[model samples]
Target: MKPIGLDKAEHAHVESSNNATVNSEKLDLSKVKVEPLFEKFVDFDTFTKSDFRIVKVKNCEEVPKSKKLLKFILDDGSDKERVILSGIKDNYSAEELVGKTLLAITNLPPRKMMGIESCGMLLSAICEYDGEEKLNLIMLDSNIPAGAKLY
Candidate 1:
């Protein structure tokens, strides 16, 4: 379905200028350019469906043959340890991430990468400055127990 005043096909690689015709009158369009606006909202039910849990990083190491992958063993308060692969090796080191309690989405389906099955995803924020990107892992403030559900 297409929304009102939001057609992408009409707006293409066309060039623009200050001069334009309007009913036999010259109009300066440079000052009256139409800037597209976007507003997307996610419903509450869809937002709450994600299972967020507190997991402690029991172990972390760089994935072999991959410069961007970092393998982590997480303690989710369960009997079996969980495995998560993150592409944050360029931002954080293995020694810095180990033994740290962080937020993770634990309900996602396991994904295999480089023969390793990642059971969860670590939460991080990407900050951009001067065309450079910095990824910082999200760490909770309080001393939350492992596998604690986030409401």
Candidate 2:
């Protein structure tokens, strides 16, 4: 196979990104505006109120007629299986998430979405790449037991 050179536009795009990162540290941002979601900081007392537990995804499946919903059956150290509806179907496959250990926020009241009751939330990491949003569900190593409290 032959190597391809950047065809004008690609070269300029790469050059701009290189410069952007190099000069980012020197930029002035005292007047910069941020998204509302990132504007506030939660107090420690309020943050500690959330109950975070380690859970294993025993089963995972897509929610019918939904583009961004996935239904997960989690083993959270409880006698019954805990169900959580997540908006991560676009980011992960059912096969990729099954049998994986993850951190879940388990104290929230159940909410009905698409006619299903979700008992908790699965934490995920979000990032931006080339102006596009990317997400990955937070997972832990297998050594951690299910339902272990997160300190």
Best by TM-score: 2
Q: Candidate 1: which pairs clash? A: none
In order of appearance, the predictions have TM-scores of 0.71, 0.73
Which one wins on lDDT?
Answer: 2
Q: Residue 28 of model 2: what lDDT?
A: 24
* lDDT, residue 88, candidate 1: 82
- What's the lDDT for candidate 1? 0.74
Q: Ten-residue segment with the worst summed lDDT in candidate 1?
A: 1-10
After superposing candidate 2 on the true structure, give the runs of residues whose Cα lies further than 4 Å from its correct spot.
1-41
**Candidate 2: tens digits of C-alpha lDDT, residues 7-110:** 22233122342332111232122322333477679999999999999999999999999988999999999899999999887777778788889999999999
lDDT (CA) for every model shown? 0.74, 0.76
